[model samples]
Target: MPLVSVRQNWIVLLVFVALVLGIGMVVGLVAAPGTYVRELKMPDLVLPDAVSGILGLVLSVAFAIAGWRTWVIDSNSTEMRLWLATLILSWWFSPAFFIMRMPALALCIVAALFVLMVWFEFRTWRRDRPSFWLMSPSVVYIAYVAAMTAAIVAMN
Candidate 1:
């Protein structure tokens, strides 16, 4: 059962958005995207930092919407929890490499995130198809991200 009335669940969506944007801000403050990333030999197809950041924001909102949709449908469902975990992992991808300066570790984290995200997508295929498709874009973007990270790990 939902812990709160269905009408009140919009708050959770805001929370997800704030939590994600806040994490991004904190990471920005600490990492600052200066010499650390620019000096590294990036992949040929690597996205510019500005473009990647914009996509990250867009993906974050996508995740928030998917999570909100799932939570409204069934707050206690296992898929809701899985979506939450996936969202958390999504927030950590950039930080794992950019902030901590661990490309290999970040690559591993992305691999795990990719697996978890795909699992979540499959889990929602029947449970909530819209939510499934809501998250579909991230799957492709994440694969691109993982390839880019893997290349960075190789080059560095």
Candidate 2:
């Protein structure tokens, strides 16, 4: 198998970020007409709940795939366990944030999950020296989650 380098992993991370942002913009545009946008004074921006669920679903899938790929590449039992936990926790975050309408609590939960993911990746990197690409996805995920949380909190 071809060895994946840190640079390659960074490229992958950038691609994933682009994909997530692109999807979000597309979804926002498509759902905009039906969405009720609330203007926030602090950030001077509009918040819409219309595509929140869809964005959540997209992020969940991306995280799952990233976790699965990392697990597969590392072949570590601990990594596998962490990936499963992240996947399950992430899957629940969307509904809790959007459907239950508890953005703050949901953000906390997801933040914890992101921390866990980073710890897992760090451990795997130390033990197995897997490509940085394996860990980059977690970084991207965390950034995305943080941005969403900021938007949610600002809107509220």
Candidate 3:
């Protein structure tokens, strides 16, 4: 592995960022919100589209870096794999709700992600207390979205 001197792990971090953003963009475009989304009875807490977009991008990138951090700590650790699962499921959330127009399915996916978020926080609390606290925004965002999705499911 000497020949692969692309050291400092920048390559790995870039790969994670690219993968998260790339898949996210593709899914978002493909699942571009339609009448179904507008027709749903959205929760009062829902933010404006621009605000949501900015917040979403921030959270998504934050999660990507978090995943990369896990890999850096121990690429083979179950924690890293859990982060990967969380990212993949998060990416699919839009498609499930916007593309497939299945609020119920989306709710389930989000619920699973929320559970994973809790597990992740518990795991990180021991190793990196700051990171656990840093993830508060992410946890709140997921919970807020989950609530919104549930509202949609119940409304229509």
Candidate 4:
């Protein structure tokens, strides 16, 4: 099979990233004031807004690093592209999970994402050791997902 041209692939990736971030920024702005509304009736919790925001930032950086590595260092292999697509689609659901406070559904989605992470790890481990670096964000994200799930379960 003929290889994909790097020029075309890079442009596509860049456009994808730009669109994701642009939508994210708009959502963030609209949702900024309502961070506490959903939990109004519940007891005051230790999970601070700043802390959640920081976590979001960390996730974003990790994702950007993984994307950069994928585009700059990895070849345009089918496996790599599949992993990228799954990661982005899964990530698109993440903020909504938090915004909606739908912890049960969030847990389910993150669990699926965790499975995807494991699959990605299995696929790339022997072939590319640095794939773990790309997959590290999943670790942090899974941790957060678990915590949020626990919190939601406890509140119910």
Poorest 10 consecutive residues by lDDT, candidate 2: 33-42
lDDT of 4: 0.59
Per-residue CA lDDT of model 4 for 1-156, tens digit only, reads: 123354757666565466545665666775453655466444354367788778766665555445544555555864467567655656545454557766567667766667766766666666555545656666666656666665665676
Lowest summed lDDT across 10 adjacent residues in model 4 is found at: 37-46
Ranking by lDDT: 1, 3, 4, 2
Q: Residue-wise lDDT of candidate 3 within 29-141, one digit each (tens)?
A: 88889787777887787789899899988877777777777777777877777777788888778888988888899999999999988888888777655446656688999
The TM-score, computed over Cα atoms with residue i paired to residue i, of candidate 2 is 0.54
User: In model 2, what lDDT does residue 10 have?
Assistant: 62
lDDT of 2 by residue, 70-118 (tens): 6445545777677666655655555555455566777787787878778
- Model 1 clash count equals 0
Model 1: per-residue lDDT, tens digit, 125-145?
988887888889988898888
Residue pairs that clash (backbone atoms under 3 angstroms), model 2: none
TM-score for each predicted model, relative to the true structure: 0.86, 0.54, 0.89, 0.62
Candidate 3 CA-lDDT value: 0.80
- Candidates' lDDT values, in order? 0.80, 0.57, 0.80, 0.59
Q: Show model 2 residue runs off by greater than 4 Å.
A: 1-66, 69-76
Error of 3 at 153 (Å): 1.1
| Candidate 3 deviation (Cα RMSD) | 4.1
